[model samples]
Target chain A: MKPDAPVLQTSGLSIGYAGTALYEHLELKLFPGTLTCLLGLNGSGKSTLLRTLCRLQPALGGQIELLGKPLQRYSPQALAQTVGVVLTKKHYAGDLTAYDLVALGRHPHTGFFGSLRSSDRALIEQALEAVGMASASSHRLARLSDGERQKIMIAKAIAQQCPIIMLDEPTAFLDVISRIETLMLLRKLAREHQRAILLSTHDVEHAIRTVDTFWMLRRGCRPVCGTPEDLILGGAMASLFEKNGFTFDPLSEHRAIAEHARPVGIEGDPAIAVWVNNALIRTGRKPSPIAPSYPCINCMGKNRFTVGMPNGACKNVSSVSELLTLLHEAESMPAQPILPRYA
Target chain B: MRAGLYPILVVLMLLLFAACLVYGSVFIPFDAVIKILAGKAVERTAWQSIVLQSRLPQAATAVLAGSALAVSGLLLQTFFRNPLAGPSILGISDGANLGVAAVILLAGNPGQYFLGGYWAVIPAAFAGAGGVMALIIYFSAKVRNSVMLLIIGIMIGYLASSAISVLNYYATADRVHSYVMWGMGNFSSISLERLPLFAVCTVVGLAFSVMLIKPLNALLLGETYAANLGVNVRSVRMQILLCTGFLAAVTTAFCGPVSFIGLAVPHVARLLLGSSNHRQLLPVTLLAGACVALLCNLLMVVPGAGTVLPLNAVTPWVGAPIIIYVIASKKHIHYFNEA
Candidate 1:
């Protein structure tokens, strides 16, 4: 095996339960010092693929190689030392403190009795510190919040000292802040530890910012894999959620749009214009500076704005809240017949 | 908290054991019992005989059976990841009951047909329990879902109970009466002659449980996490099944299906320790189980006017309240948080 070979590789792989396949004849590779994000709609086989890669579930057909060897050839214990995993399900550790839970990662390295050596303890402490969970090391898992629990689980994987780590929807249950923190932590681990980290997430926007590579799985299609920029520019993400009126906007990093969004023109200072555009977009109105025959907004100051109707009737507002409320009411009103002069 | 509680549990267990030894129908004074235990000749010969032959074995049986049943409950609860799981819940004890029913009802005079002695019933119970355990293990392999496997166990238990009920309906009056007494459960059934075998089996089961501390702790994180940690989930599960089956079977065969100890004691240990790390929980559970069982044995003879309560009848009074506490405060209880 070449030293520069990807940390994980799969060729012509098929994944699913029983004889049925959710995906087939796939090729993928994850390299060291890179974070890869797998994005897909629910039930698109992201988890199944991860399970197959880790050898937790049998692949329907194909080859999975870890560290440049066939996955099946490594013993379960050997595979554990090669690849660590954080599953989507919540772990129940009974009354174990955060420290005790992380120490369990030493199972593959510890003695038969699972006694931790001094070196093992130091690694566990270091892993906890890496995830910023050192303060909660003695805290019971039950007492910690979902974000804290996730960090602790990551710390456990780190303590395992594997070359590759896989997580299934690690950010699924966390708040926005935690979601960003977790993705950022994964990116840091990949770069600093020189480990290959692969995670599946629904938080595609955040993932796009932190991941080195993106693997997109869409229903009934071959998985598309590339750098974040390649997938975005190549329109792979747009096709991912294309059925639900969702489009991936590269400039804004927004992956989905509402089906009934209306276009609104805005002219203002660039700084205030960005905020106004964000406000309009959030309210299901597409803000653009160049659209004619549509209602337009002109931001004259930080807290003042004018709404110009297609009929040339203008309403002035002093606050964003009032502006939004006026826009909402106007949009809800039925359109009046256009006069000959306005037309 | 667990470290402090260990010495307390040891003292409590010893006190309960002494209580069981001294307070029986023929009450010997505590000092006299101690003297008798030390192999000294007492003034009354009958007191020595009662203390030596009956109370000594009864107390020993309670300790062994209690610890064995508690350990079995802990293993099953962890394996199923269900707090309500126990030896009885999995139908192993019911299987033993069916075995005894078969021997006493289908065969003529349980003592006359096979081995011509009381010893025949034990092997029959072991076979029944072992057979049902094998069936459950087979189903477990086929059914990947733990909840589904648990439901299968409950259904298997119901089938065994139904079979036993049919046997009860057709058996002779005297045989039915004896069977009813056995079903009520008794710690005194194992005479001094049979205590050695009982001790051996219980000890072996408990020892095996100790060896599984690491895997049990791993499983506390769930099967996926355990497997990720290099635990062979299939083999560990099978080992747990075997240990639980053997312990529950041996205790049921000798003691006529002692109740609640197997179901309730592990929770009591967790409550006491405030943690479920099996290294501490298992030993504390063993001690707490012995204490609870010994206390129940003492309660059985509380009336003292030549009337004794059935072990099963007395067990629920102690076990039910603890279970209720667990349920009532389940949200506040850290141990039940995952469940």
Candidate 2:
């Protein structure tokens, strides 16, 4: 975390839809420069938590504060300047271009007439650049693909120049590559801009690999908050799955069932990614679409493919003696692709 | 004027105004018509009175009513965020109708209804308009969604119409006849004596509209986004409801429920501006509205005639096609940011 004030906090808060209570007695704080991934199963109050913090769906009990100011204490204009929200719902209703949409972030600072001042335009351009959307700056909101649209939305929030950016399931409609790219962009924002990027995403592996901290919510349980390593190492990841059938493999440090887990190996560098992918398929592993993002080598064929192992040794392998070492490295880095080997 | 909107509107309005000045229910030569306007000697007393008194007021009334209705329609469309929403849906004008109904039917007996004197028409209209405005404001406060409010407004209009029907059913034949004439809708109903009051009310409503131009732009972004931008959403909605009600009520009181312009002109204006910026939208709405109403009024002259189309019939023909065009075109203009 960047030594800054907390960007989002809930003090013993209860949240709900208009008249119905969904969750209560919740307290949390997210500091600047920390990418917090909020997770929960459906109906576990994930969206409810976000809405309360955003102060859109008002809290029925306790208070939510941003930057130490009670959420309601800040005027709408003041709050807009301090906090930018990207809801998963709306893209844009108006026939505005990408520049127009991003420039809307400056709406808080711009006069009621809402003109584009030079500084405002420059900041808008900068935000687009930050989101890697500079090339698409002139695109209309309706004309872009889902991932591009999400980036544009974040670009708009950045244009507001708020310290805290809260997004609710921003990757919901994006394709896998777009989702990972968006997550990477968010991490970049947190690391480089020192802005808090708190987002709720259904992409669990992506979140685990990219975000600094986790806010995990399960039905009938208090939200579990901790660093990703703590949550994974402390056997918290096992509880996230079914206890009877699904189990965490300590040797591999991955979430899987012991009965179905299998080993398949190939030789040579750069073939590891494809070897593991084909092996997982051979073993009837579901092969979640996101498992192959990292490049890997196969010892037998000396070919490369992007395939990070779920629970296996993967690194440089001169001989089968180094198989365990590669698995440990793969688990530790999570981003590393598991290489094919024989020990 | 970029699309030649302002110029087209000005030239069209000027030519129509001139036509109204020259041709009328009574035939007058072009030379005499030009001479009368130039303050030269004219031969005919009746022609002078018809041209100077009847046609001039009528033309002025068409311009005023048309502009007011167009701007009001534009405001309501933006406020409700619905293509179908319009000023008449609120029944505010119908509320004025009921008020005028009461004055015409139940106020006194037959010919003596005018016994309230020439002063009665303007005050009665203002009161009726004020009454409807109050009702719409109250309903607006109760409803949260603009779409819901629009539906409720339609229901209110039906209720007002029913009430007017009941009043007509019970009134004497003479009162019924006069009320029916009133409902036909007229451009020359505002006499020279009553011009100042009508002018004052319309100007005040239009001025209020100008003040609202800023908030109206924010509102086009949708409610939550607008609130995020520090717009007092509830208060803005209330103010809009009041403005719509007031404008509709005033125009209705004087023009006898002038329809179509309130609903279609805004869509036309939006097409003209090609953007949602209210700064441009509001003026375009005003000019287009004035042109439409004045042209429709000019249609009444029919080259050498005074028999105008019933305002409601002509308005639907003019208003419906524009509305259809907007909807058909809407499918083509993609909403880019709908994530």
Candidate 3:
């Protein structure tokens, strides 16, 4: 295979269960030294596509080429040597240590007895260190956090020495920090190792920042593939959630929920005003810059605030909660400032 | 630690084997037993027969049966990904029991069946166990879920056991008496003459298990991951079913559903080694099963009690507490929640 050729390429591929195609005639490519994120709504065939690509499930139609060879042609061992995958489903690895779990990635390379030779041991250690889990090599999976366990799983994939790696929802269960860390790790692995890495994830914001390519899957639509910026510029990300009655917002990297509310002007330090604006939006109110009127919140900074009422009365408050409460009372009282004044 | 534990387990198994041989219902002198085992002429001919024929075969049967059943249990537990899974859980042993019940109860005279010697039950037991295994393999392929396959196996076992109870109800009193005695399980049934056949079948089944260690370890990551690692998941599943079936069937055939050793020894092995990698787990389980079985055999003799307990009666005493501890211990919960 040419060095610049896609490590995993597909043309007119269809994937689904038992003759019914959830996706049909799809074109996809994963190039070396690039991280691709497969993004989709629930039941949009993300998992089915990954499973079919990994040969865990049979494709309904089309052809997949792994390293310039037809997927159906490679033996299971050869295929394993080329493609490494980390599934979303947790397995019975709790009793195994990080080293033991990662060593499992060397199955295709190991001999008949599956014993680790010195070279295999070195690779296992390198894989562990690559994932930054070298210190935790002796820790059993059960003792590790979910993110740590996921890192070990990636280390196992790395130890496989495969040119292409695919993960299904690798960050689905991790906290925000772990999600970012895992995505950063994937990008690092793709770049430093010059391997093609594809991961399916719901962490779109992080993926947008870290991944080089995006495959947007929508039901009843031809799968769209491009750079994350290209998809956003083309407005494909906005409509990706259209079928589910959601408008995807690229800026937020989530479904945009339109909130209708009365606008309240916030007069405060710009830094403090941003948080106050966020608090207002969360409470079904919009923050407006024009603040020279009643029904305005004065953010005096350091968590102290004053709410101006329509009745020309001002309520001093020490907290955002108190400010919002005074605003609530003024709004509920039909243009009358009914909030109790403190002496 | 596991490296040190392996030799200790081997030593323990050997000591238990010797103890089983030395302290049966009639205590045999250690020197006389050693001499007999060496094929030397002992002072009394009866001592020679007692050591070579009675105690030796019984001890050997315990070792073989223990290893076979324990490995079978390990395979089932790992295959199902359920720590609670064992030989008896799938009803393969009960199928063997049903087969034995059919041979003893349906045949006109139990004495005539015994005329072929203690080997008569082997064929029927194999058939019964093999039949259930075939059904399980078929369902395992059809049902995508392991727990569902496990439930179906249990239901099949219930059917076999219910059939046995019905057979017992219709049989004559003396025939039922003979069937019940067989149900109690005894290692002494495999005489010195028949030990070779039992040894061959058990060893072959265990060899198949040894070949499965790599795939078994791969499967610890579940079927999809194992497949990704180049394991032929379907073929491995079939191999596991066949190996566990052959081992469980052969041991149940000869030893009459020897309990607890199959279900509990793997857990003991895992706890001692602190790893489920199956590289060490399989062999350690084999040796530990032998040790436990031989120990149970020695426990049956009860030293100076002058009476031998039924094999099944002594097995639960050793097996049940280990299983209970495994279930109750928070440390091992990761092994259980897999299913």
List where candidate 2 sits over 4 angstroms from the true fold.
A1-3, A17-21, A91-94, A132-140, A241-343, B1-15, B30-35, B38-41, B45-47, B108-146, B333-339
Per-residue alpha-carbon lDDT of candidate 3 for residues B102-153, written as tens digits (9 for 90 to 100): 8888873565554453555888899999999999999998998888999999
CAPRI grade, predicted model 1: medium
DockQ of each model against the real complex?
A: 0.54, 0.38, 0.58
RMSD of 2: 7.8
TM-score of 2: 0.81
RMSD of each candidate relative to the true structure: 2.5, 7.8, 3.9
Q: Pick out the ten consecutive residues of candidate 2 chain B with the lowest summed lDDT.
A: B330-339
DockQ score, prediction 2: 0.38
Q: Would you estimate the TM-scores of all the predictions?
A: 0.94, 0.81, 0.91
- Per-residue lDDT for B158-266 in model 2, tens only? 8878988999999889999877766767787776666677778878888889878767766656776676656777788778877877777777777788878888887
Best by TM-score: 1
Alpha-carbon shift of residue B318 in model 3 (angstroms): 0.8
